[model samples]
Target: MSDQVVPAVINLDVPGPVISRHLYGHFAEHLGRCIYGGFYVGEDSEIPNEGGIRLDVVEALRALDIPNLRWPGGCFADEYHWMDGIGPKQDRPSMVNTHWGNVEENNHFGTHEFMALCELLGAEPYISGNVGSGTVREMSDWVEYLTRDGDSPMVRLRKQNGREEPWKIRFWGLGNEAWGCGGNMSAQQYAAEARRFGTYCRDHGGNKLYRIAAGANSADYAWTETLMKQLGELGCAYRPQPFMQALSFHYYTIPGTWQDKGDATVFDTDDYYRTLAKAAYVDELITGHANVMDCYDPGKHVGLVLDEWGTWWNVEPGTNPGFLYQQNTLRDALVASLHFDIFHRHADRLVMANIAQTVNVLQAMILTDPDTKALVLTPTYHVFEMNKGHQDAASLRVDLPAGVPARETLATVSLSASRKDGKVLVSLSNLDAGAPADVELDLRGGALSGVRARILTAGNLQDHNTPGAPDTIAPRAHDQVTATANGLRVHLPAHSFITVEGRLG
Candidate 1:
């Protein structure tokens, strides 16, 4: 293993824009209990719910200020025909959810219910269109039903179904997992179909519809390159015909081996470091994919939307493996912080990101068990809430002393600083999970008085939260600080993430 040397002076004078709401976007799939018991639990259930939605889950998400939510499926979206999910719940058609457990989907939580949930969370809805098993007309009609304000057939159907006013849904996924669940088409085939579907996905002049084409799996730069070139050529020929606003990418970090993914919270130190390294791939993926986009369109017409991302591992023992119900731990929090830092640094190219599922699913923010107090906040959830300062805040440049921490693995350190009100908030995370890092801050021109720190770490690398011991590893205030003459010299713990806030006097 060889170590790559990086520059010590990282003078980031270029102030980047605050991250978008969709950066913290979440996913709601028809997979297993993610929908049935995870989010919607019929109104008749004894549990407290509003219109079948778990009230506790809603409240937890609200606490995190969940920005946007993607619905319907991972593979489920591609095969999903929107019509089956609309109309009166009783009259709505039933379909076999072949992609997830082969269970019968009783078309109860359809367009209206989803939009209602989004309204409840105050999150923007990002809907994935069916491009694999459904027709182009199906995709168009769904869009019309959601965005159209006129008296079209879909709009009339909307009125007949109850929702008279059109919901403001702007993000539209062209397809999902096209290489696999989404028809498993070659790049050329998916590109052609994407164009056809995107053409019919009209703006309706309501809200600016950001049409996102399904991107490649991890390291599949060819998929990105081909799509960008094809889309760019089409745009050149037809000024703005069926334009793409973003390209969606999906990546999950699993340790040990791909076949046998280790538990999220029961991993060794090596697995812990490896997991962080795997999560850091987002930076490389963003850069490589962006380079491809730059080749076709230097102006960056299409944004890189990390629609599906987070840690994935074997399901908790004794639980249904298909449910994807796993523990959330301090390791997850570190992963979240590291990825959030990467997204902020690349805010120019990276527009939106969703951490897999929101609640009761893979890498969820909140988990529940019929309101009997099984709700546990994963470490990932805490990092999101902690880093909200970077939301829509300007990105700052910070210089650090560079030294090799581990052999073979690539290492880098940087901090994104944002000023809100009269306080300067800085989020710092070390990508290296195996080695501790020493950093010196060069805040000469800036004021850094009255600085305090809050850190989220644990005694062991595999420490996690359980329903029995929920608050065992939550973040706590670590306000010990020393204001040096030159700048602040902080010792960062290995595999830990910290956020420091200072009021500029």
Candidate 2:
């Protein structure tokens, strides 16, 4: 391994914004087997499920301390009718999921089931409302049915559905991708619809809704600009409260063209670095959108929510093309670590971010086999578990004095630090395919001791966990970290992600 000392400094006193725990949120869509087989095995099945929800999946995600779960879909949300999913399972109508797979949706995992999932995982629910094929009345009624407690028509309907008390929901999406899948509406057109929809999604009882308007696709800053401008118009003089609280955008890391996104587990060193480089582009996308938002709202009142993100690759061989069941490898884990480092750095304006999916979909954390009832925690899952300490922690400034060395296409090293409850956590990733990094970290502003560390890596970048070998790429306690006179020196392996924890002074 090539020896490259990457000098870095972490200032404990130069703390930035508190990294919102919501930044560690997850998304669950009705795409592919993500809902049916991945998370929800029939209650009668022998998968040891709790009311048709997989207990094993819940247990695995609990380790991540998943803050929020966006539900009903990416494209499915625009076509989903909440009323159809609420009633009895037997009586619920079935519809074809045109957006993904074209499979029949039994509507069993509706509003109640989703809420049950949130409760089991102790995660807040972030519901994406229908906009393309649904009416404003339909969206309003859904909000009331879930959050209104007093005697009202929607509350009566909730009682009829066997639930007396209303469930509390805070985050709500006005639409999905309004520019394309959601409706193919123009940015100007969607902005007008967002204002109308946000007006009716009222704050019922003790629940105050944080409405997020569907935003830019990838680098469509025009959409963000239009929404921000319209939002300001709503709060000018007459209306004190803005129509929407936040704006959302979607971006996925693809190594190649969308039609030919390279295979997840079959790639050379060039492909690996290319994927990392594309993932790194998200920082630029955030900056571009944030600049437009800053011009409109310099106070940073409006939050930017990256609701849909993570890698998108060709489906595994023999799987249905519509089903996005790609294998997660050590490389995927590096992508995640890099994204989190960027997210932590922009915690000031970037309020929340949810991985594209949590299970059986693109960049999933857990993979489940329906036939064998086996669950495998992906390498990316370990990254989430390892970096969970950064959730809601005080963000610390990490400066690479010498600057991270570049590999083939992008920087080979990534670093981020945060403090919480007298403890400081430093997360680092070395994306180099065959070179180790000697990161000399100078801890300033505080004295930290009692260092402990863990690392996630495997023999190969494409190495992934299969049912036969679930723990092939799991994280283990690392011993290559040594305390220095000022701070610590970490030896990071090539294509590995590590987290170091130390008690603060």
Candidate 3:
């Protein structure tokens, strides 16, 4: 750790475009307990709910102001048929979920249920089309059924399915992971198919289509380069109309060995630092991929949608290993804050990012207990709630003075700030959790008088919240920040995230 604090002045005068809300996107897959027991509990649970969807969980997500949620499946999206889960719940057919544990999936939660859920959270629904197994017509019709207002065949079916109004879905993923789970196809093959399918998925609602093409697996820059080259410059005659608005990429951080991944709750200092280092790669991926996109289209029409990202590890003992379920700890919270800062810093190219599954699944926000009817909020949830201000706000760069890295595992400290409604909010995260860092915030040449801070930290990096002890690791008010002449001086704890709120009064 370096004791030398280099004095650098940052002119906060330069304010980037208000942050896009989709930058806080979430994901809900039809895997594990995510759908059946997590979000939906059938119309028969003792817990208060609408159509079996937990009310407590809904309120929790609504408080977080969830911007957008990717629904249906990771791989299941390609195989899911929207018509199956609409109208009468009993009449809906049942299918086996092959990608996730081969569990039986009843048609209870179809298009109507999902749209209704999104409505409850006031979130935008980003549906992934089934380009791998389904035909072009099926894909196009699904779009019509959800977004069409006129009396077309699909629109008529929507009326029959008990919904009179269209959903007005904006973000449409052309396919899931096309290179693998989304039906393996060559770059040229997928690009050609994308051109055909995306063309017919007309925007009946007049909403600009955000058709996202399946991106490469982690670190596969070639896949991104090939897709961008094939799609070519946007607005070209040869290019498909409104050609893919964004490219979807997926990445997960696994501490310890990649094969024998360590447990989320049980980790040592080494594991904690290693995970942060691995998680920081997200920024590198964004920069590398954006560089490739610049070669083809410099206008920055296309967005880099980190559609899937989070920490992955072995499921809790006695739980289904195939379910991809794991515990959320303070370590995961730190991991999420770092990613959120990274996303804000590069908000220009990184338009949206979804943190894997939502509830009771991998890196979830809310966890439920079918046996005890208990609902617990994970540490990651608190981070989301604290940082919600970044949504749709102007981004300002923060200068992180050099200090001893939080841990040996992390190398650099990064920061981002934003202003909304006369309030200047700054988010700071120390990558190295082992060493304390002093940050002198240069408010872009502005004066700071009265300021308050709220911080999220834990007793230990490995600490987590369980049903028995849910509030073990959560956010609390901190007075460590002092009022200075130029700006505020913040002493960030090792391996912690803090948000300082300053009013321009």
Best by TM-score: 2
Q: Which pairs clash (backbone N, Cα, C closer than 3 Å) in model 2?
A: none
Q: Tens-digit lDDT track for model 1 on 1-505? A: 2322322232234455656656878899988678888789888977788899888888888877888899887899987888888877889889988766678889899888898889888888889988888888888888888888978898998999888888888889999989988998999999899888888888886567889999999889999987877665633332224557778888888765777889866667667777877877788988998887776666665689999998898888877666677778777877888788778777777889988888778888888764464677878888887787667766666554445354346453546676656667777765555555655666644566788888777776678777788877777887544566655666567666788887666
Against the true structure, candidate 2 reaches a TM-score of: 0.98
lDDT per residue as tens, model 3, 1-505:
6532323354556678667889899999998889888888878878788977878889999999999989887899988887777778878899988899988888898888888899998999999989888888888888888888878898898998788888788988998999988899877788788878888877786766789988978888888877787666543333423657778789898776767888878878777778888998888988889888777767777788999999998889999877888899888998899899889888888889999878988899988887888889999999999999889988876665455344454654556788777777788776565666777665555654467889888768878888899999888998888766666778877778898887765
For lDDT, the strongest prediction is 2
Report the candidate with higher TM-score, 2 versus 3: 2
Of 1 and 3, the candidate ranking higher by TM-score: 3
> Which runs in model 3 stand beyond 4 Å of their true positions?
1-8, 233-241, 401-409
> Residue 464 deviation, candidate 1, in Å?
1.1
- Candidate 1 has an lDDT of 0.77
Top-down TM-score ranking? 2, 3, 1
**lDDT assessment of candidate 2:** 0.91
Q: What value of lDDT does candidate 3 attain over all alpha carbons?
A: 0.82
